[model samples]
Target: MEKLLQTVRITINDKLYVKDPESSDLGKRIIRESIKMIYEIGFESFTFKKLGTRIGSNESSIYRYFENKHKLLLYLASWYWGWLEYQLVFATNSIPDARLKLQSAIEIMTQPTEIDTAFTHIDEVMLNKIVINEYSKSYLTKEVDQENKEGYFVIYKRLVNRMSTMIKEVKPSYPYPSSLASCLLEGALHQYFLMDHFNSLTDCSIKNTPTAYFKHLVFNALND
Candidate 1:
């Protein structure tokens, strides 16, 4: 029989939640089920009341972990970017070539996700779907400026900074490392989103074995 995976704690910005969900079984359930529900029914239709029903917990319990559904969304997105950063570091750790490191990062960013066993309660692959489709909603709101001031986006910025550094290493004089890196992150997401919703907006076939169009776009920009 396969051994049960050990629980893994994923830390996010404390500012995103009223309580630490990974600290208890109930909290973990809240995060795990919330991701699944958000992916099932987009954020607009997701509610703590519904999540409460699915998890067999009361809505107040869910609220204790997160102030509202919006905060929960931010928490989920932060965890994903942090997780992606971890993937990028692990994939590029042994690579010495700057270009190869950047390429690895791009591949991880665009590739379809598989469940990460570390966080057993959360379905990372489905969480990734939520990230791709609902990520923009995390920050595009009236309170974005306040959230930004509170470092709500640090994890995302750090991931972008990591890639920006790699791009700079490849072309030291490149004046747009950050811009190029952010474009690769946001552009790939938008492409995937388009492929899922408005098929006409993007020609990228995410189902294809090799997710290379993103690499093609980024490498060309860097090569120019």
Candidate 2:
């Protein structure tokens, strides 16, 4: 898997950035630092100016890569989803059983993230935290319709569709495969958030993970 990942490059939407951050050293630094900064201070308080000061570069340099903080957040979110899609494809492609393949995909989506050494410039762990905590800010906006038209969310939608297809494979007669696919993806994030901030509201935790909960939920629904 590591060898396969070494040959992979995560593609992001061109409309999401003025310049590709993976193209240059400074660009890579911007991504590496932005993930940490956003993870530390929360998106509401993060800015390119602060990121510039942290990375010892001019704030204008960041604008050359991204139009604004919102676009930067979108880029990060897009990249994370693309990276995850690669993992999902590689991990489950060889499984012969439809049920086992879908089970592996669920584990990839809901399991706690660990650092992926394949991309040295990007921290998968911190990026996962940003996705969980600040991802909604990227699309929960007035311009979402316009951005959707512009294809800013193509990668994320594709990831969901991949899972939706697997669900259909497991249960050909299932009518709500797409809806259930989206629920598992988004619900994993929500369950993690609730586990951290509102423990009493959720049954998921360190011992009882979202992965276990979703696996039970999905298999039961499909079998029923």
Candidate 3:
């Protein structure tokens, strides 16, 4: 626990420096402490008074860094995505083969490490709420332009394209489209995590676990 706290402190310091390079040492300390507090209490339950007390600074001092709670949460979400992108890129870069690349991506996505587990839980709790709220609203629904929709599709499409390229190398005669590969990966993840119930008739077991099922899907995708 001590080691984890030290690591989080270091990460907070690094992030604070990146965001505000000119900030004083004292300012960085306060920001780092505030982040630690947020990780413990969560965004919804975190209070200005509690943050101030933890950092040994008043609410006014904290406000200098962020205008409001919503703004802070937005910044955190952007930072979290940036970190995830870095990890994903690094994990995929090591495997020379396409099949291995796809396998590595699935493994990374489904299995959360100790550090990832902490951040993932917080992100799902906070960001998922915001996403659900926005997506549920009529105004927000209409506001999603084609470009933004395409951007979201691009992430999945790129993964499929990479897998397809690899599959071609392995078996040039394979008939499955990149879209189908994408669907299989996405569907497997959704069913395993987001689905309310795993239909036993399909021989799928929630008890079988995400990593096990994900590996099965990857193998089946490559085989077919």
- Who wins the TM-score comparison? 2
Clashing pairs in 2: none
Which is superior by lDDT, 2 or 3?
A: 2
**Candidate 2 per-residue C-alpha lDDT over 1-224 given as tens digits, one digit per residue, 9 for 90 to 100:** 67877778999999888999989999999999999999999999999999999999999999999999999999999999999998899899999999999999999999999988899998999999999999999999999999999999999999999999999999999999999999999999999999889999999989999999999999999999
Model 3's alpha-carbon lDDT is: 0.51
Over 1-224, each residue of candidate 3 has an lDDT whose tens digit, in order, gives 54553343112223222244124665556445545656566556777678788767788876676666544543443344344444556678867887677677666555433354433224343342232222223123453465245342243345557556655665677777465556554454454444334454344454666667767865786586
* Clash pairs (backbone) in predicted model 1: none
lDDT of each candidate versus the true structure: 0.85, 0.95, 0.51
Clashes of each: 0, 0, 0
Prediction 2 TM-score vs. true: 0.98
Better of 1 and 3 by TM-score: 1
CA deviation > 4 Å runs, candidate 3 = 1-35, 115-208, 218-224
Tens digit of per-residue lDDT, candidate 1, span 36-93? 8988998999999999999987899998989998889999999998888877887899
Candidates 2 and 3, the one with greater TM-score: 2
Give the lowest summed-lDDT range of ten residues in model 3.
9-18
Clashes of 2: 0
- What's the distance in Å from true for residue 11, model 3? 13
**Using lDDT as the measure, which candidate wins?**
2
